[model samples]
Target chain A: MRLFHGQRAWVLQRLTALVVLLLLALTAATLLIGPAPSYERWHALATSAPGAVLIVIFFAALCGHAWVGVRDIVLDYIQPTALRLPLLALIAFILIAITLRVTLTMATHFTVGA
Target chain B: MPAPPRAAPKFLNLAQIRFPIGAIASIGHRISGVLLLISLPFLVLALERSLRSEADYAALGTWLNSPWRALLLVVMVWAATHHLLAGVRHMLMDIGIGSRLAQARMSAWSTIVAALLIALLAAMRWLS
Candidate 1:
C-alpha cells in the first residue's frame, strides 16, 4: 500500500502558505497602524465580518500548512513507521483541536453581541 | 547465488561537516517550523483569553507587558518571521525561481536578514 504520496500535500502546503502569507501581512499592517492591543480593539476586529472570515481562513490554512510541514519532518527523522504514524496522528489531533477552539470562540463571541 | 555483503564504512562526525549559509537557512526553516508548532498552544490560549472577557483581555495585556513575556514574544516573532521568509524562498524555488546555487544562497541570506529585521521591529514595538 502506498502510504505516503505527498504530491497533493505538497501543493496544498504551498497554496495554504500563500494564503497565510497574505493574511499575516494584513494582520501585521493592522496591528501596526490600528489601535493598540486592547480588549475593545480586539473585540471590534474579531467581531467584524471580514476579520472573522479572515481569522477562520487563516486558522484553517495554518492547520493544513503545519500538518504538511510537521509530517515531512517526522517522515525524515523518525525511522520507525509505528512511532511516526502515531506521532503524525497526534499532531493532526492537536491542530484540529486548536482550529475548533479558535473557530468556536470567534463564532460565539461575534454572534453574541451582533 | 547470494549477493556479496556490503562493508560498513567509518561514521563521519557531525562536527566535521561544513554547513553553508543556504543549508543553515534550510535547517533554520525546519527549526522555526518546530518552534512555531510548539508555541501554537500558547498563542491559541492567548487568543482565547483575549476574547473571553474584558478582564481576561486586561490580564493578557498585563502578562504581555512583563519582561518574560517580552522575551517569549521576541523568540516567537523571530521564529515566525524566519519561517515566513524561508517559506517564501521555498515557494519561489518551487516555481523554478532562485534554483541556482548562488541565487539560492543569496535568497537564504536575505531571508535571515529580513527575519532579523522584522523581529527587531517587533521587539521595539513590544518593549515601547
Candidate 2:
C-alpha cells in the first residue's frame, strides 16, 4: 500500500507508544509487587536477560517517540526559525543523552559485576 | 414575499459548538510524552536512592512527600492518563470502528470525557 511519510511516522509512533505503555505498566508492577530490593538485587534484575531487554526497548521507543512528538510541538508553537530549530536540536540531544547515560551505566554495572 | 428564502446558515454557535478534538488530543498526547521524558531522570534518581539502603529509602520517601514531588507526580499522572485516553481513540480509528462523521464526533467526545475523568482521578490520588 502507498503510505505517506506522515503515515509511516504515525505508525512508528503508535507502535512505540504501545511498547512504552506495556513497559511502564510492567515496571510499575515490578516495583510495587515486591519489597524494594538492595542495590545488588536491583542490579541483577536490571542486567538480567529480561530486565535488560525491557529497559533497552523501553528507552529506545521512549526516546524516539518523545523526540518526534516534542519536535512537532516546538515547531507548532514556536514560530521563530532559528529558535525553533535550536530547541528541536536540544530535544534531540536530551534524548541521546538519556539513552547514552542509562545504557553506559547499565553496561558498566553489568560487565564489572557479572 | 420580501425576498427569495435564504439558505440556512451553517453555524449555530461556531465558537461553542465546533471543537477540534483530534488536535486537542494530539497536543495533550505530545505534552504528556514530553513531561514524562523530562521528569524521568529525577524518578530514576529516586529509585537509585531507594535501592541504596533502608535509610536512603526512608530519605527518598521524605523527599517524595514534599510539595515539589507531589506536584511532579500530579503532572506525571496527568500526562499518563491523557496519553492513555487518546491512545484508545487512535486504536478505534485504526480498526475502522469510528470512521463515520457521527461516530467520529462521538469518539472525540469520548476522548474528552476520558481525559477529564483521568485528570480528576489523578488529582484525587495526588491530593490524598
Candidate 3:
C-alpha cells in the first residue's frame, strides 16, 4: 500500500488518528477508575501482556499520524525542494527510530518480566 | 503567440491579514500537531524511564515535577488537548456534521475553548 502518498496518506492519517483517540480514552478511563498512580502499578501495567501490546499499538498509531500531519505542514510551508526533502527525511528517520525504541523497550520489559 | 495570464497580486503581510475564527482553529491544529510531533521523543523517553525500574520511575516523576519541566509539561498538555479536540472537529466535519459556516465557527470556538479549559485543569492538577 502506498502508505505515504496521495489518498493513502490521507486515509492512513484519519485511521491512525481514530486509533490514537480510542487508546487515549481507554487510558484515561483506566487511570480514572483504577488505583492511584504509583511506580509499582505503573511498572506492572507496562509489563503486562495486554498493556504492553496496547501501548505498542498506541505509539505506532501516534507516530504514523504524526508522520502524515508533519508531512502536510512541511509541504505547505517549505517550498524549496532541497531544504524540504532533507527535512522530511530527517523527520521520517527520527519517527522511525522512536517507534523502534518504544517497541524495543516494551519487548525487553515484557520478556524480562516473563 | 497569446499573452500569458498575469499572476494575481499577493497580499503577503502576515500581521495585517486577519484570520477568521475557523481559520484560527485550523492553524491551531497545524501548530499543535507540530508541537506534539516534536515532543514525541520526550514522551517515549518518559515511557522508557518510567518502565525501567521503580527507582527510575520515581526519578522520572521527580524530574518532571521540576519547575521548568512542569511548565514544559503544561505546554505539551495544551498541544495535546488542542490537537485532539480540533481533530475531533475535523472528523465530525468529515462526517457532514457542523460543516455549515455558522456551525463550523461555533465548533471551532468550542474546540479552542475546551482545549484551553482542559489545559488549565491539567495545570491545576499538576500544581496541586
Candidate 4:
C-alpha cells in the first residue's frame, strides 16, 4: 500500500491557491484604490469586521499555500531523509509562528476601540 | 549472455541548457514562492510595526526611504506580481483552460509581460 498519495495534496493546494488569489486581489485593491497608507486609514480598515475577516482568511490561506509549495520543493531537492525532515519541520514552525503572530496581533490590536 | 555495458553517466550543464518560456515561468513561480516565504517574517514585522501607532508607521515609512529597503521592496513587488500571474496560469491549466502547448506558451509569455508591467508600476508608485 502506498503511504502517501499526492492527489489530495494537489487538490488542496489548488483550493488554497484560489483562496489566496481572491484575497490577494482584494488586498491589492484595498491598498491601491483606497487612501494612501496612513495609520488612521489602515487602522480603520483593520479594525472593521469585514477587513479583519478578510485579513484572517488571507493569512490562513497564504500559510497553507506556501506550506504545500515549499514542501514540494524541499522533497524534490533534499535527498537525505534526516536533513529533509528537519528542514521541513523548521519551515513549518516558521510558517506557524507567522500565522499565529498575525492572528494574535489582529485580534488584540484591532479590537473594538482600544 | 554477457552483462550489458553500464550506461555512461550524463552530467547536466546548467549554463548550456536553454529553458523555454513556459519552463522559465514555472521556475519563476517556485523562485518567487521561496522568496515570499523567506520574506514573510520581515513583511510581518513591518505590518506589525506600522499598525502599532502613528509614530511607528511614520518610522516604517522612513525606513522605506533607504535605497536598500527601496530595492528590496521592488524585488518583492516583482516577486508578488510574477507569482500572481504564474499562479493564475497554473490554475487555468488545472481547469483545462490553457493546457494546450500553444496556449500554455502564450500564457507563460503573458505572465512575464504582465508581471513586469505591474512591478514597474508598483516600483514607480513606491519610489516616487
Q: What is the C-alpha local distance difference test score of candidate 4?
A: 0.84
Predicted complexes: DockQ each: 0.85, 0.35, 0.86, 0.84
lDDT of 1 by residue, B25-104 (tens): 98889999999989987887887787778999888767867877897888888999899889989888988999899999
Which residue runs does candidate 3 get wrong by more than 4 Å? A1-4, A111-114, B1-9
lDDT at B22, model 2: 64
DockQ of 1: 0.85
Would you list the C-alpha lDDT of every candidate in the order shown? 0.86, 0.71, 0.87, 0.84
Angstrom error of the Cα, residue B110, model 2: value is 3.5
Model 3, B45-120: lDDT tens digits are: 8898888778987787677677777877888888898999999999999999999999999999999998888889
The residue pairs found clashing in candidate 4 are none
DockQ of 2: 0.35
Report the number of the highest-DockQ candidate. Answer: 3
Weakest ten-residue segment in model 1 chain A by summed lDDT: A105-114
Return the clash pairs for model 1, or none.
none
Off by over 4 Å in 4: A1-5, B1-8, B124-128
2 or 4, which is superior by TM-score?
4
Q: What ordering of candidates by TM-score runs from best to worst?
A: 3, 4, 1, 2
Q: Chain A TM-score for model 2, please?
A: 0.78
TM-score list, all predictions: 0.88, 0.73, 0.90, 0.89
